[model samples]
Target: MIFLKLFRESFLFAYDALRQNKLRTFLSLVGVTIGIFLIIFVFSAVDTLKNNLQKSVNKLGSNSIYIQKWPWVNNEDSPWWKYLQRPTPKLREFDELQKRSQTALAVSYEISIDNRIVKYQSHTVEGAQIDATSHDHDKTWNFDFEDGRYFTEMESRSGSPVTVIGHDIAADLFPDGGAVGKALKIMGRNVTVIGVFKKEGSDILGISDDKEILLSLNFAKNVIDVQNASYNPQIVVRGKNGLSDLEVESEVRGLMRSIRRLGPNNEDNFALNKTTILSNQLDIVFNVLTKVGGFIGLFSILVGGFGIANIMFVSVKERTNIIGIQKSLGSKNYFILLQFLIESIVLCVMGGLFGLGMVLAVAALVKAGTDVQIVLDIKNIIRGISYSIIIGMLSGIIPAYFAAKLDPVEAIRSN
Candidate 1:
């Protein structure tokens, strides 16, 4: 009952302080508000960007390995000419690995070609990303169709003039739906659309599935010079459910070495790259960003803590006579300390809430104006409040201690 009364009185005192000197209180807490805003905003943005990138990378494939002539990132230890001379993965190599690999659930290959124009009679859509893909490629991509079905294995092998259009292309060419079985001139060849990809909205990172069209490998070869090493045709393999990705990749690597006729003494010429490479790289970068953001926020928060401590000291000095009166009335030293501490904490909390509100407002504005999504999650909110409480307690400690230790006789005489 006593603690409750003390807390109530402290709350009123804190509220009255703010009410009496609104501008001064706001000015004092400005540091805390700015610091919290910076830290939370940065954390939220970095996390959202990381998630977006990971999602984009996932669209490439998960539990899937890419066998290519060149590594995803250039190797500093090896001569560039070594990789330059390596042969681009071929359909025959894909077939050999598919026949031999035990850990793989699906094996396929794809080659990206130059962007080309597509037309459906009068309606024309230009600069559509095209991929020439072999059998089981769609399985590796794991696309959920918006309309029609994936091309049959026979259609893929025989180099049938069929194309699977992305959502945007489908919309542009056949807005009324029923894009399947429609004859569209793609890259000067009339091909029937066999499948349409689901809608994936625009991304600032330029990673979107809605702008691509898939073609049969053989059909693409006939149209473009895919045999050129610069085209970078890659063989993709998916791991079995029970198998580890590394195990699948290892089996593929051994099969590839044998198929390439490389002896045990020779180094494996081709690179077996995983989609997780992009994710791992991005994680490292985000970790660095987190550290940088932390340090930058720390400096501002330190200043804010000092500002709060200064406010507590001034508040104690301003209310010294009140403290003496309470002590003379038989209030305990601990109670005086608790009251001042609670008051300081409440003030800090008010500032923290304002800071969080500002962040949420900016987050909403960003979401409304841009494709980038900034989320102020529950975890962040809790963290902000916790920081506020801790800072408040630390800042108030000295002032609360001094107020508690003051001699009631001297304090009352001075006032």
Candidate 2:
């Protein structure tokens, strides 16, 4: 009961200090406010980047492997001519691998052609992305259909003139919602639209399916040379549910080597790419970025701490006569210390809250201006508040101690 009464009285004293010197209190809080804003804003930006990156990486399946001529990771030691000379993965190799591999659940041969045009009647979507894949592509890659279905085995093998369009294409060409069974002209050949991909907005990696059209590999041969190295033909392999990507990659590497007749001393020509490679590289980059941001924020916070300490010391001096009067009237040393400490804390907390509000405003503005999302999560809020409390304690301790130790007679005589 006594402690509660003491707390109530101390809180009132802190409030009174703020009300009596509003301008001085506001100026004293500026440093802490800017410091909190800098740190929280940096943290929020880094977290937003990480989230977008993870979403992009997920689009390329985490457990899938890509067999291609060029490696995803850059190697300064290796000559570029080596990769340029490597042969593009062939359909024959893909067929052989499917027959031999035990760990792979699904294997697909895929090639892409860009800047193509698709037309329905007078409506046209130019510069469209087109992907040609074997029938097993559905099993290797994850996707959902907004309408119709993927190619059947017979249709894929027989080079049937069937196609799947992305949401953007469907919306552009057939805004009324019934896109399936419509015939669209591509490469001067009319093909039946068998499916429409679900809507996926633009992402940082430009891998969204919103602007792509999918067709069978056999059918794509009539439009472009499927075996052309310029088309970037690659094989995608998805591991079984229980198997790890490493296990799948190992089996794929051995099989490719055997198929190419490469001896033990000869290096394999093909590259086995996995999402983990990109994810690990992203981790390194983000870690460095986060550290750099934290370092900059800490400097700002240090300046704020100094400003808060200065204000606290001056506050103690200004209240010296009041402290002496209370002490003469039988107030305890601990009460004086607690009162000053609480006042300093209240000031810092107010500054922190203002900083948080600034961050929220910036986040809202950025979200409105761009597709990117900047979330100020609860974890960061807690962290900001914790920093405020710690700064308040460290800054006010010495001043509170000085006020507590003052001799009533000497303090009463001070101007």
* Overall lDDT per candidate, in order of appearance: 0.82, 0.85
lDDT of 2 by residue, 1-415 (tens): 8777876776676677678878877777887788778778877877777777777777777789999999888867977798889999998999999999999889999998889889999899999989999999998887788889989999999999999989999999998879899999998899999999998776655678888899999999877899899789999999999888999999999999999999999998999999888778877887887778667666666677777677778878887888899899998999888877876777778878888999999998988888568967788888877788788887778888999999998889885
TM-score of each: 0.93, 0.93
* Model 2: CA > 4 A from native: 1-24
Count of clashing residue pairs in every prediction: 0, 0
Clashing residue pairs for model 1? none
- Please list all clashing residue pairs in model 2, or write none if there are none: none
Candidate 1 yields a Cα-based lDDT of 0.82
Measured over all alpha carbons after superposition, the RMSD of each candidate to the real structure, in angstroms, is: 2.2, 2.1
